[model samples]
Structures are given as structure tokens and as C-alpha cells.
Target: MSDENKSKTFLGFDFSTQRLKAVVIDENYEVCHEADVEFDVDLPEFRTSGGVVRGEKGEVTAPTLLWVKALDMVMDRLIVAGVDFSTIEALSGAAQQHGSVWWAKGSKERLKNLSSEDFLHTQLASTFMADSPVWMDSSTSADCRAIEEAVGGPEELAKVTGSRAYERFTGAQIRKMHRTRPRSYSATERISLVSSFACSLFLGEYAPIDLADGSGMNLLDIHSMQWCEEALKACGDEKLSKKLGVPVPSATVVGNISSYFVKRYGFKPDCKVVAFTGDNCSALAGLRLRSGWVGLSLGTSDTLLLGLQEARAPPAGHILVGPTSEAPYMALLCFANGSLTRQSHRDRLVGASWEAFNELLQATVRGNMGYMGIYYDTAEIVPRAVSGRWLYDASGRALDKCAPQFEARALLEGQAIARRVHAEDMGFKLDSSSRVIATGGASVNKELLQIFADVFHTPVYVQDKHANAALLGAAIRAAEVWSVHTNTKLTGSEPSISPVATPYPDSEAIYTPMLERYRQYVDTIPKLQ
Candidate 1:
């Protein structure tokens, strides 16, 4: 690569639940600069707890202008960090999936005529119709049921929209808005997912939702990669389709940076804005996962991601169009009880020391000597269960308690097994050739990763930089879109990954029966309920 090519940087932004993060990468994918703005800390006037406001009955939201302020703050921080915005050739971003932003009437005109003299929040203070109902919100059960009823049932809804009517999904959220807040719905001019809303801020107009992110809404037809007419009517009226602009391919260059950004932030007038996508899809691109490979992100909430040659709308989990045009489809399975559950158990049973926790885990034998457990510090998504812990002895008799070491091992093994079972149920196959790429906070725990390897009967690998996968993915998308648009070939080695753990020789034999037993427990729980 020439010096000029090396100097050209691509920027990726992540509008996550808690913060707005940005990463800049050179042509070779080396991270050059990074910055973030935490909504609660940096913009405390909004009085958000964990970046959202909670209300009665599982209502969670963030003020729409909070994000606008975050954008301004993050941009200023990037400049203060000595980042040259003009050198950035292109940019792309990802946001928390399923959060919807309603643009009030005439907001597009407001976006187009933004003044460089003022901060974005001040200029667009009244642009939004209401606080955004985020992915964490669970106040839409009635809306979900209505939507499911409108389109047959849950199975048929999944067949058409790549997901059942999830309460947090955009379709259900939109229905809630239309039915409960009819005036806001009537005054709404456009509906943008968190991803496209971020893109619109850059493009100076409403940006189309990308196919990959659009799939999360329970509104897009996964097979055709377009909005489903039936699903649209289920969400709102005839104008609902227009509120959501045409969905575009994830890598499509939506437009150039808005003049406000060009003037205020020194961004080049020609800097391309690639279509933004959901954070999960961005991580898939960032990890460079191939077919048959699974990406496990072990953060506050664990997520399992894999690529699919053909789309399958499973009875659970979700299916999204792949971030890049080359890949066909992708699956995302979220487990709500992840690191927090692990931390709680470790604190209670092992004195809050990870080293002690690891020692206990390593000392205990696999399958906990026929003991099995399922722990849910909070509600679980994969199984859709309530909070509690269930433990059983080898003979399938309920156990009131067990040894601390057995408890630790059971916790790790159970989480791993649950991931594999749910993933396979989604049609993800496993074999000698299959690989599991682990990322996020827990991936650093070699002992935990070994449990993952052993339970899945596959090798587990970790990248040099796993924490920034989503931000890196956005940067990668920017570079890819730029390469195609300018007809330039990128010359660089792919990001490197190193194997962390390989399956034990007897892993399949040990876990196969355990998997069946685990399924039996899961199947019995609903009956007990």
C-alpha cells in the first residue's frame, strides 16, 4: 500500500445501549483512533440509568435527543484526540438492534437545514416524536400478540418475517405507538431503526434501513429481503410502508456526509456514508466469520451468531440478512443471563475471585459427574424462562444443593450446552471442520472457553482485539463499501485469530447424552409452568 492509501482512514461508529463509540481504521484494518461518549456520564442531563429510563411494567427508553447530544460529544472528542476527519474516506456504523426512532413531521427539512454554528441536539431538539422504545423494553406484550394474530400465529409470523413477534422488535413497538399514542403516530413522518437513524444524521436526510438490520424488525420478509406487506399492515396503516423507506443492502453507500458535519467537524465533503446495520451483523463482519463457523459474544448478554447458506426462521432466536452481499443469511441467538449470572455465582460460591473460580472449574470433572444445572439470574431468552436455578442429580432427582465445585462446573457446562442446543435447533451443524470464535468480556477466560470447546465439541478461537469487534466491523464495512465504489482493490492480510481451546477427545461422547438430558429438563419446565 502507498503512503496515500495508508493515510486514508475509515471510521466506524457503534450506537450501543450505553454509549456512542467510534473507531478509525487504516486501509489495512489497523485501528488508528477510537473514542466514545457514555450517555449517562457524558450527558447526565438526561438522567438515564444505564443509558435508559425505566418506567412501570418493563418500559425502558432513552430520550431521542440524548443520542443527538452523544453524536455531537463523540465527534468533538474525536477531534480533540487529534483525529483528522478530512483524511477519513468513508464511514459506516451499527446501533442497538430493534430500537425505533420516530421523526416528527418536517424533521427531514430540519436535518437538511442544520446550522453548523449550533450543536446537533439544539438544532434537532423537537425532531423526534417521542422517546425511543429500545431493545430492552418489554412493555409491548399486547402489541406482540396483536401482531402475531394479524399474521396467522407465531410460526407463520416467523416464516414470513424471520422472527416471531418479539416484544422488543420494531413491529411490535410501532404497533404499541400507533394504538396507544395515536397522535404521535399520526404526526410521524418517518420511522428509522437505530441503525438508519444514525445514518440519517450523517446523510442529512432519512436513510433507508439496510437489509441486514431491517430483518430484526419482525417486519421484513427474509426470503425476499424486503418489507412484508402483511407485516406492514399488521404494524400500521397504508402509510406505514412509506414511513419506512426502501431497505437497502448493508454495504450500500447511502450518501455523503451532511454539510453540517463537513463544516463543523472538518469531515471531507466527499466522505461516503455506507449504510449502517445492527451491532450483531457488524460483529459478524468484524469477526470475518465463514459458513459453519459460530461467533460467541460473552458480554453482559451472551449472543451466538453464525452464517447460513439458506435462510431458516427458527421457532426461536432470529435470522437476519448477512451484512455483506457475498454472505446469504445469518442467525442470532441471545441469552439474557450471561456474565452477570456468572459473576453472581462466582461471588456467592467462590469469594468473588476468578482465579478461585477457575481452580474449582478445572478441578471438577466434565458433566459434573451426571449433575446438571440451569441458572437464570434474570429471565432467559433462549428458553424464554423466568429467574431461578434448577439442579438435578445423576438419576434426574431434584437437588436442593450441591458441592461448590460441582456448582461452578455445572454453571459453566450448562451455559455452554444450552448455547449449542439452541444453535443446532436453528439448523447450525457441527463437525470436525466447525470453529467457534469467542469474543467479548468472558472470552478472556481460558477456563470458560475450554468448557465452551468441550461442550460444543469444536475448537474455540479468540482474536487479538475482541472487545471492539462491532466498532471494527463498522470500519471494515466502510472500507469494503469504499473499495467497491471506487473500483480499488484492498491489499492487506485478514485479522488474525489464535486457537484458545480444542475439544477433549471424549467431548462428544460425554456431552451428547448430557445434551439430551438438558433438553428433557427444558421440555419439562414449560409443563411444570
Candidate 2:
């Protein structure tokens, strides 16, 4: 570390569903400060539950100005915590993937001409034409179906845009807006993903979507790293292309800090702003994953991220462009029913105790004595299954119920196996050198992690600061971009990680046959429905 660089710091912000978090790291890439603003708690005026408003017909959205206000509040909180904003050389951020923000006609001028005398949210209160449909929204199923059909079919759409048309994707959401809210859609001048919208706040101009995050929307052609015209027509019209602008590489330096931030918050005028990306892509950067390594985030939903040398248009899951050059393509598999499903079963069958749940899991033998089950408390994304629970005996005959220990083990094993299956289908190769970097709320559960290790036939590792991966990733990206633009070197440090679980010797032998049986059971799901 150079003495000249010792005083420099970088900032990373995360605009998540429930809260907005900020992480500051010095030139050494070590965290020095942190702050956050919870939407439901800090911004009560929005009347949001879990940071969003749920309407009829499975619609979920968040007030666009709510995020504007959060940025205002989070910066103030950072200042209150004694962070020296002037010493911050660069900043970047990550946001929940797939949420689209509509900038009303003439809003670009409003963003660029902001004054330091007033708060950002107050000035931009009417900038958006409508609330932003978030990732949790399922109201776009019909739109998704129409898009897939227009583009030939599910497989062809996947080949073009990296995944089959999904309800939460921004393209479908945009299509819904154009159909149901034509006035708002016509009044809109520019459309930004949550990631780019946050970046635009810093740039004081409309920011182009980064390749990594742009891939999440069904509008981008991952193969060409450009917008797909056919896909765009499927969503709306040719004019939609201009509203999206051109996409940029994730690490591109978008611009300098806005004058509003410079005068109001004491930020350096020359501080750079890197293009922001999806939270999952930022987490991938934060973990510093390498070849043969996969990242598992076990939270409200479970997502598996695999870095790919080349893109694969899997029938299930999603493929995104990597944030950094080391990995050019990435595969993502999301399971909608994660911790909540486990908690439900635990509450109903094990006295609502995780310790008891663990005890039950430990008491049961491998493969749950050939008793397998699939549980979805809500609609599942991977297999597209509806809410239901199906259990089977060794011979694959359906059963109404099973032993509590067996039930507990079944849920854990089922989730692990499903992750492995979908990941492999997306071209994830497991071998002796392969390892899983686990993070998120449920990653702390050693018993659950063990099941993942056994099912994937690989060891599992966790970092000391796993929960803040998205925030850290944004900071890392900021530092990387700043270092390149300034021709300065960074004092890099390895993350503090340790292996939490290793596969048993007979793990592969035990779970190999279960994979086929699990698939067979999954095939019978729609029939049973």
C-alpha cells in the first residue's frame, strides 16, 4: 500500500428490496464504514410493506420516488456516521434485478438541472410516470407467454435473450405498461433498470444499462451484447429501442459525480461513477469466484451462480454477461421457494425451532431412506411448478405424509438436489476441484449447507462477511474502475473465507440415483395438478 493512497476511499451502494445499504472501503479494499435505510421503517410515508406495494392480480411494485428519497436519506446517514465524502474517489452500486423505472417526458432535463438547495426526492417527486414493477411481481405471465410465442417459442427466446420469457423480466413489464397504461407508456421518454436508475442519480444524466444487469431483461441479446430488435417488437415497438439507449460494459466509467452531490454532500467533483449492475452480478464480483466455483445465496429465494466460458441458452434458469473480464458469461438458477418454505415446514412439523429442524435432519439417513418430496409454498421459477407438496415412497408411489424426520430431510435434500440438477442443466460441471461459496441468511445453517455439499458432491465455503456481498462488490467495482482511469494500483486483499462443510465419501454414490428419481417425480407434478 502506498502512503499517497492511504487516505483514499471508495463507495458502494445497494438498493435492495427491503432496504438501501451503503458500504465504504479504503484503498486497501477493507471495509471502514457502513450504513443503511430500511424502506418500511425509515420511509413510512410510502406505506410500503417489505419495501413494496402489493395490488390485485399478483402485482407488486414500489413507488419510484421512494427510492429517490432513500438515496437522499442514505447519504445523510453516511455523513452522520463521519464518512469523509470528499476523500471518496469513486462510487458504484447494485440494485435488485429486473425492476424497471420509467422516467417521464422531460425528466432527463430535470435530473440534469438539479439544485443543491433542495433534496433530490422533493425535486423529482413527479419524475416517474408510474410505480416500478419489482422482481416479486407475477402479473406479467400473459405478457411473457405472448412474447415467447412471438419470438418463435420458449427455446428460441432463450437462445436470443439468454432465458425463456419470465414474468419478472423488465421487457414483459414494459409490455404490460404499453398495453394497460398506454398514456403512461407514451408519456415515458426513457426506461431504466433499477441498477442504471441509481447510476443516473449520480451522473445527473440518463445512464445506459450495463451488460451484466441488462442481460436480466429479456430485451437484450446476450450473444451480441446489444438490444434485440425482434424481442423489442415483441414487447412494444421500434421506439422502445431509443428509450433503452445503448448498453455499456459493466465496468465502464459512466461520468463524474453530479454537481448536486458535489455541493450538497461534499463529494469530490472529479469522483467517478461506474455503471451499476444487478445485485446478483455484484455478489458474483464480491465473492471473486473463479472457474469450477459456484456461488449459492440461500435467502428468501435460493440462487446459484456459475461463471461460464461461453453462453448457454438453457431451457430453464438464466444466462447473464459477467461483470468482469475474467468470466465473460454467467449462468443463474433461481428457486422461488427457499427459506420461507423451510420455515413453514419447520413451524408445522418441528415446533418452529431451527435447532429441532437440524436435529431432525441429522437423525435422518442419506436419501431420506428413498423417501423424496418437493415442496413449494409459492409458485416456483425453475420448474414453473404451482404451490403444492408432493411426497413419494421408495417405489415412487405418492404418499400423503411421512415421518417428521423424513419430512425435514426431504425438504433440505429436495432443495439441494434441485439446485444441482438445474445448475448442471445450465452447464455447471462438478468435480474434485469444484467448490461452492455460500452466502445469504440461510447459508449460516451448517446442516443445510452440508446437504448442499453432499448433493453437489463438493465442499462448501463461506466468507466472514457474506451477507454484504452485494455492497462489497459495488465498492470493489468502483475501486477497479477508479484505479484504471487514474493509472493507480490498489492494495488488494483476499477475502476471509473458510470451508464450512465437505462432502462425505459416499455422497456421490448415495445421491447419483436420486437425481433421476427426483426428475421423474418432477415430471409427474403437472399431471398430478
Candidate 3:
């Protein structure tokens, strides 16, 4: 709480609705304490004409209550760790991007009651328990299509917001919320991005939305770095303040930790609350991927991001927007496709134990481009509006037909081609001449890494996913705030391993014809409209 203790330590939350990762790092940036709090994301389903759905189909949404539980668990873990709640300097967070949480008009005052035993018992508990639509669930594609028609299409949307109206984007979700839940939308005080909501609540102020999360919103004007007045007015809200709107630097000192949080954490009264950011941007920071360093994330989804010195609107279908951090900008191309696709096919054939699949995969010699004949879809269902059309074989079987292993190889080949196309479309080349670093779960897989290296014809550096980089990035933001506010010589989160890489010992074959076909397929898909 005093000037002497300001440099002690810091804390952060990687706030996901499903699971919360709490991290404690001292002034040296080493992990002193950390815990992952898991909770159910009980999003009730809405009835659809076909089935229960998420956005338009009577699909259910994640409630704000789950978020509250995640918070409670995170807080409880931090407390149990015997962390000097006061020495925690300040906190910020990384959360699911574009998900919205509503609050009553004056909920700002309500957050200061951190010590109240009635915390979960309040109405706030119930709200978070339901309807927190994550940044997936493409049930709202219809809504996106409608909006695209009204707003002149995806290119128009991109020109203004640096993104298209994808079903998973926050903009489509917002429009869906307004039409289906007018009362809730009207009663909503500030439609908080999950990142902003957490930072605002803990800091005891109306926290500003940082560039990363704000960039996910189709409503935010990427060129100007503010909410688009025309879009907001057209969306039927003239008063912009009610919605979380503002683009602050990633490390901006939004405010100090509220007395309630300080007392609860036992942090000094002067602990500063840093600006919050999104998981994607936080991951970039955690990776320590600076300029000229391209980051490839192969998690449940795949994200290829390049940090830049200034903001640039994504050309046509490319995604160019604010870095999830305080950097000037970052260009990202994310595909909903990833290991999930591989798992689905494996689930069907290999059953619950993936060890068998791994063994089979390991024993299977890499034939000269075993997947060269297959054509996988990028993002699976975008452009063509199709899903799971496995159309390929490995052992020189059928012409237009398929084999069992077809799906598995297709998923990989498709995503590889998708990555290659995305690079070229975004004005970046995928040749061996360019620099690239791969992160995420898939990066650890030797085969996947080799495939990517051969496809891009570039060496792929594997990053250590040891600690959740996003959580560490959140700590970086928190540490920065603590330093500037209290003159604390706090440490920032950084990667332990260097990103330099070496090639696999296997033959790095190139399938020129397959690469050509994949590029053609991606180019033929209709633009968003």
C-alpha cells in the first residue's frame, strides 16, 4: 500500500467464461503463484425452427452469471495462495473477445461491495449464469448476412470497422440481442466487452475498452479508433456512452484498484488497475512476438497475427485491426479450423483414446504428400456455407470419392492451404524467405509443424506454451500500470524460450499442384454479403 511495497508483485486474470486462469508474478516477472479455476458455461439454448440455437435459432446465450463464478473462483484461488492481496499492485484481464455483459444503469457503485457475503446471492449471480454468447456459435450467420445486405456488404463493413460481419463477431451478436431482447437491451447500462467489464468492475470505474477487444466489434471504427457514429445511430442507439466505447492503449492506467478489491486482495490502497486487453492480443504479448516476428497460434482455432507499427484496415476479406495489446496495430487472420477438426475425425474412428490414433499416425510414414489429393475448406463453413464435405483420399484410391483417412488429412491440408492463402491475401508472402513463429497446442505436434514448414516452405519456430501466454500478457499490462502509477519497478511477462527454429529431419517435399488447387478453391468462395 505504501511507496516501498509498490514494486512488490502483481496479479492478472485470463478471464474465460468456461475457465479462469489466475496468475501471480513478482517484481522479477517469475510466477510466484498461479491457479486455474474451472466452471461451467451454462448457456441456455434458445429454440430454433430446426433445433435449439444460439443467436437467431432461439439459440441460447451464455449468461453473465458464469462470468461471476469464474471471477469468484479466481478470487478465491488468489486468496488461498496467501498472496499479499495489497501487494498485488493492480490487475487487468484477458477475456473472451466480443462477448457482452449487461449491467444496471448504476452498477458501477454496486461493484465496490467486494466483501458482501451476499455477492453470489444477488441478482448479478443469476444473470451471469446465463446468456454469455462466446465468440463462436455461428447461428447468427443469417443475422450477419442481413446486416451485410443492409450495410452494402463485407467490404463496406471492413472499410469502417476493419472486419467483416462474421457470425462469430460481436456486432452480429449485438444486433441479435437488440431484436430479441429489447427490454434487456434497454435496461442495459453499458454493454461491456468481457475484458472491459472485468477491468471496470475490479478497478471501480467505467474502464475504457482497449484496442484489441474494441477491434473485434464491427461497430468500432478501425480507421478513427472510435465507435462509428453512423453505425451506432443506425443500430438505433444514439447515446454511445451506454455501450462500452473507447480505444485506450493496452497498458494505459485506467484507474487504481478500488478500496473494496484492495481490501479483499489485501493489496495496498494505491495499487493501480491497468487497462484490460483481449486473449489474442495478450497471447501476442506473452509470446514476445515483436515487429517483423509473425505469430501463428494453433489452439482450438488457428490465428496468424503480424504486429505492425501503425493501424491498417484489412484489405477486402483480410482482418486488419488493433493489436489486442497497446501496439499501434496487428493484422490477424483467424480460422475457426484447428485441432478440433482433427479430433472430430479421430473421435469417429479412433474412439476416446487418442493414444491409438497417435500411434497409428506415428507409424504411418509420410508418403509424398499423402494429402496432396485432398481439398480442405478454410474455416470449414465460410464462403460456401458448407460443412464437413470430406472430399479426398491418400492411397491413390477414388477420383472424386474418399477414404477414412481422408477427413484427417483434409483437415490439416485444408488449414495449411488456408494459412498460405491468408498470407498472400493480406499482402504477406508465405515463402521460406519470410520469418514465422508457431505457437498453440498444434505447434507441439512434430507432424503438424513439419507439414506447415513444408507447405509454407519456411522454417517454423515452436514456442513453449508452458504458461498461458494470455495470462502472462495480462500481467504485463498490470505490471506496466503498477510501475507508472507507484514508481514500482515491476517486471513484465515474457517468453522463457527463444523463437529461433531448425528444420525437421524428414524430407520437406513440396506439392506445387496441390498448392495451386488450394489457392484456387479459396479464391472462388463468395465474399461476405
Top lDDT prediction, candidate number = 2
Question: Better model by TM-score, 1 or 3?
Answer: 1
lDDT of each: 0.87, 0.89, 0.63
Which is the leading candidate under TM-score? 2
Residue ranges of candidate 2 with Cα displaced over 4 Å = 1-6, 343-365, 393-405, 527-529
Question: TM-scores across all candidates?
Answer: 0.92, 0.92, 0.84
Q: Give the TM-score of candidate 3.
A: 0.84
Ranking, TM-score, top scorer first: 2, 1, 3
Choose 2 or 3, whichever is better by lDDT.
Answer: 2
Candidate 3, residue 285: CA error in Å? 2.0
Task: Give residue 159's lDDT in candidate 2 (0 to 100).
Answer: 93
Tens-place lDDT per residue, model 2, 432-489, is 8889999866888999999999999899999876466778889999999899988989
Lowest lDDT sum, 10 consecutive residues, model 2, at 520-529
lDDT of 1 by residue, 285-353 (tens): 888887678999887678899877778788999888999765788889988778868998999997879
User: How big is the positional error of residue 492 in model 2, measured in Å on the Cα after superposition?
Assistant: 1.4
Off by over 4 Å in 3: 1-7, 40-60, 118-123, 126-130, 142-153, 315-326, 367-369, 372-384, 394-407, 430-434, 464-467, 487-494, 498-501, 504-509, 521-529
